[model samples]
Target: MAWLWLVLGGLFEVGFTTCLRNVDGFRHVGWTLGFLASVSLSMLLLEVAARSIPMGTAYAVWTGIGALGTVLTGIWLYGEPATPVRLLLVVGAVACIAGLKLTAGS
Candidate 1:
């Protein structure tokens, strides 16, 4: 359950960041609101997950998911380049995230 919360938090972390990209320095009202909402939910979920998960593990997984998702979102939605090296690094990040999950003490 905590892991689920963590994952959801992480995904929301992605949502907030993606929304931020469209926020135009907080000038865009709709995107700014979206960012605010997503970030709030993300933080709430993270807190719930942290109740059981080790702090370091929870933080790493959360950040890892956000980072991975953000990169993919950039590539697919924003038309960012998917160079071989970048792809390989993303895969490595995924592996590291998985490793952290597998070895989490909680």
Candidate 2:
């Protein structure tokens, strides 16, 4: 359950970050509102997940998921750069997130 919350939080974090790019420096009311709402929800879920998980581990996983998701979304939707180097970096981030989780377990 906690892990589920953490994943949801990560997803929302990605949502907010992507929406922020569309916000045009907050000039777009709809995008700004969506961004704010997603961020708020992400924070709430993160807090809930933190109750059972170590703060550092939870934070690392949350940020890793959000970053990887956001970059992938950008690449798919906005046609952002998707070079091999970028893909490798995303894989590394996933490895780090997995390492953190494994370490936390022991």
Candidate 3:
């Protein structure tokens, strides 16, 4: 359950970041509200998960998921660079995230 919360938190992390792109420095009211809501939910979920999961592990997994999702979202939605090297690095991050999960012993 904690793991699920962590994953959900990570997804919200990605949501907040994606929302930030449309916030226009907080000038865009709707996007700004979305960003605030997402970030708040993300942090709340993280805190809940951390109560059971090791803080370091939880944080790493959460950030990894966010980063992985954000990178993919950027490439798909914003047309960001998806060069071979960039993708390779992303894969490496995925590997590290998997490694952390495997070793966490949760």
Candidate 4:
């Protein structure tokens, strides 16, 4: 359950970060609101997940998910370059995240 919450929080973190680009430095009201809402929910879920999961593992996994998701979304939606090195690094990060999860004691 805590892992689920952490994953969801990470997803929301991705959403919020994507929204940040659309926010135009907070000058756009709608995007700003979206960013605020997503960030708030992401934080809330992360806090809930932290109640049960080890702090270091939880934070690492959460950030890993967010970072990977943000990068992929940027490449797909915003036309960011998907360089081989970047993709390889993302895969490496994914492996590390999985390793952390597998070793984490529930």
Candidate 5:
């Protein structure tokens, strides 16, 4: 279930990133706490997953998931530019992540 933990960790990565937006430079107390908690949980889960998954593969996947999710959320919720090039690049990142997973032989 290391893969599962990795996925969950990735999700928490997204959570912490999203929560960071609300931190208002750490002026917002509640959002700051949420961000801290999410970061802790995400890192904890990553550490657990790394015991079974190769460090490189797991780290790439985790960051890839977080980047992909955060970009999508920014486009959808924050009106960030959803340029065609940006979308294609994100998809390409997913493809690379998938390739990494498939080749990992885990």
Candidate 6:
């Protein structure tokens, strides 16, 4: 259940971050509302996930997913640089998140 919340939180994190790109520096009201709502839902889900997951582990996983998703979206949708080095760094982040999850005994 807690893990489910973590997943949902990660999804919402991605949603909010993606919406942020459409906000046009907070000029778009609809995008702004979507961003705020998504962020709020993400935070609330994170709080729920913290009940059973260690704070450090949960936080790392949440942020890892969010960062990875955002960077991938940027590369795919915004034509950001997808250098080999950057890709490796993203892989490393994923490995660390996995390690934390495994070792945290969740």
lDDT of 3 at 90: 99
> TM-scores, in order shown?
0.97, 0.94, 0.97, 0.97, 0.96, 0.93
Global Cα lDDT for candidate 1: 0.96
Off by over 4 Å in 5: none
lDDT of 6 by residue, 1-106 (tens): 8888997899899989999999999999999999999999999999999999999889888998899999999999999999999999999998988888789887
lDDT of 4 by residue, 1-106 (tens): 9999999999999999999999987999999999999999998999999999888999999999999999999999999999999999999999999998998896
For residues 39-99, write the lDDT of model 1, one tens digit per residue.
9999999999999998899999999999999999999999999999999999999999999
What's the residue-level lDDT of 56 in candidate 3? 99
What are the per-residue Cα lDDT tens digits for candidate 3 across 1-106? 9999999999999999999999998999999999999999999999999998899999999999999999999999999999999999999999998998889888
Runs in model 3 lying further than 4 Å from the true structure:
none
Backbone-clash count (model 3):
0
The reply for model 2, stretches above 4 Å from the true place, is none
Give each model's whole-structure lDDT. 0.96, 0.94, 0.96, 0.94, 0.94, 0.92
Which residue pairs overlap in candidate 5's backbone?
A: none
How far residue 17's Cα lies from its native spot in candidate 2, in Å, is 0.5
lDDT of 2 at 89: 96
Give candidate 2's TM-score.
0.94
Question: Relative to the unseen true structure, what is the C-alpha lDDT of residue 49 in candidate 6, on a scale of 0 to 100?
Answer: 97
lDDT comparison, 4 vs 6, better candidate: 4
lDDT of 5: 0.94
Residue-by-residue lDDT tens digits, candidate 5, 2-104:
9999989999999999999989999999999999999999999999999998999999999999999999999999999999999999999999999988998
Task: Output the number of the lDDT-best candidate.
Answer: 3
Where model 4 places Cα greater than 4 Å from the true spot, the runs are: none
Q: Residue 103 lDDT in model 6? A: 97
Give candidate 2's root-mean-square deviation (CA, Å).
Answer: 1.2
> Higher-lDDT candidate among 1 and 2?
1
